[model samples]
Target: MEFSQKIDVNILRRTTFSPRVKNARIHVICGPMFSGKTTSLIKAVKSHQKDGKKVFVFKPKLDNRYADEAVVSHDKNEVQAYAVEKSVEILDYYLNADVVAVDEVQFFDDRIIDVIEKIANDGKSVVVSGLDMDYLGRPFGSIPQLLTIADEVTKLNSVCTFCSGRARFSHRISEDNGIVVLGEKDKYVPLCRSCYNELKDK
Candidate 1:
């Protein structure tokens, strides 16, 4: 009778591990111009408010198209927001807020990303809305990175002016050299890929 070799079971023992669960999260609503990103953001804020959550809204000072201190959608839906010239200024009014909403995120500097991330990590929910791409179809400021780290992303679409197809790009009708030309229907139109490419080629 040969004795079988005994396996060392103790060596297989592993350390106890548990992943950290986060209640707070980041939500992003992004798309081209006229995609109703602000509308979605407002809806979210109202929903949270109905639940008795303390919500705070912030918008860049540069966006005074509708109101000096309010976030306004194309359809005239408006929500009061603190107008801040710098991203860090948002922290001044974030006290005891359960939910934070940011409109026109693309207008803010890159520092906005860090500020938003910090708010989320501190157990406060964050909702952000902005254009994902500029007129040239390039990723706008800080939005691409925000999309990557966001827990949820909603990409809205608009009707193409040239065609009835879903528009995913913002085409600048005006011949402006600068990237940031602040205007509404007078300057920009929504276009699908085919229509945008056609117009771009012309």
Candidate 2:
């Protein structure tokens, strides 16, 4: 018998492999403090959930300002999320998810960029929120990379506390010189370029 004739058609059909559809996309929300980045991320998650899509939300373990296992906005808007210390740990809870939302993304290590890319490439949509710049007015961790690779980028702006204009910089008000100090209105203030220059050195 010929090899083709001896082969089972059902087996061949079952063994065939096709690549996953390229429906994945990365969405990034970045801005200075109090610019509603987390709120935007939470909105995306809720929209996906309302459509009956399976969604996974994650926040850095270091971010516990509002809750230990939730993404909370400054206005008290909140959504439950997984608190992971490492970016790779997100994969452990992302199985079969249709949408993944990450808050306080700047707090995670550089590996977060790769993890988020992998998730999007696997045909799952990813939404990330973080500060684009540190208190020193420099690019924050992994946020620049995430912005570069994102399919959609939204840069929001808060009302500048000093001038009432659009805030573009996160100004530090406390005496601490550390780059990773986590605080709300007590330690950080959003300022426009002119206001920032005036207050940054003082």
Candidate 3:
């Protein structure tokens, strides 16, 4: 008998590892750079604050899109936040908060996974938002790991430059050939994969 066909069905047991389904305590919001992820993150924090929960906001020190001490959305809405280069720093800043909110998570190193995991293990609601893909359509950074562990994942959308379709990637057109090029709207455009490739060919 083949191994596949010879199994004792009644005694066999199967186990699956589902991080989100098993412990859906973390929340993640991800999209392209201009997708309003920060806005959504802020709103969730605000709602928690209104409910009288202790809330804290954090961002990578490298992402100073607006102000050093605030998390700014594409629409320019700002919220007070703590800036840290490592995820462990966030633990020091918001140890007592009931909800921990993180922005620009893609800018952080992969070690952030440990920080986020530790915070979530404390039974606090963790909300993180960042670009899922870099300007070149590759995985950005630590955001993907967070997505897998998060209980809820909100994939946001940005208005595409070439059409009304939702934007899923950030196209980078730079005179300099480098992966870490960072700039405002001039260096990037919100586009779907189709539009992005079309524009990329030009």
Candidate 4:
């Protein structure tokens, strides 16, 4: 379903930020809506917890679709998390965390790149999940930049709602042109390239 959803967190279980390269790691899980990004993130966090490592999970304050104070997957799986307005705020909250995971990361500003990098550089593992492209099929926010520096990257696909083919895009059904319209089945549909292309220009 996803690439390495069972990331080994044991490599990051030591103290000390020295020689951070071996200890620090960044993993990214990205895809269109309904592709299970958040579900994968929840699994990754659980893996870290299973290893007895301290973890902190965060969601962009803009994402309140399923819940305001937790990261909830499309299937209703959830984990307690803090909602932060600024990416830098993630730093303040990860006081003793050995691993940090963020969902709906594309909603945050470019500062997220620096924040994620800083966390990893300090020897804490980081995993981020978000939409890789916007409604127009353009790279959304800082995801491209985040992907460039990730230690591991997994791009997932979903069943196209229209044709049941592999879906790698989110087709916006709403009339709003605003970039950040937080919504679910009412406003967006998972789509394959052909299905998306047919509707993109309409």
lDDT, candidate 4, 160-194, per-residue tens: 99899999999999999999998888999999999
Mind giving the per-residue lDDT tens digits that candidate 2 earns over 149-189? 99999999999997899998999989999898999899989
Lowest-sum lDDT 10-residue window in model 1: 13-22
TM accuracy, model 4: 0.88
Residue pairs with colliding backbones in model 1 are none
Clashing pairs for predicted structure model 3, backbone only = none
Runs in model 1 with CA error above 4 Å? Answer: 1-22
Model 3 lDDT per residue over 1-202, tens place = 6467676665655654445423326888999868888899999989989989888899888777679999887688878999898877887877788888998788887878888888787767789998899877888888778888888999988889889688998888667667666677898889987899888767
Worst 10 residues of 3 by lDDT: 15-24
Per TM-score, the best of the predicted structures is 2
Ranking by lDDT: 4, 2, 1, 3
Which parts of model 4 have CA positions greater than 4 angstroms off?
Answer: 1-21
Q: Which sections of candidate 3 miss by over 4 Å?
A: 1-24
User: What is candidate 4's local distance difference test score?
Assistant: 0.92
How high is the lDDT of residue 11 in model 4?
Answer: 65
Worst-scoring 10-residue span by lDDT in model 2: 1-10
Root-mean-square deviation of every model:
5.5, 6.5, 5.5, 10.2
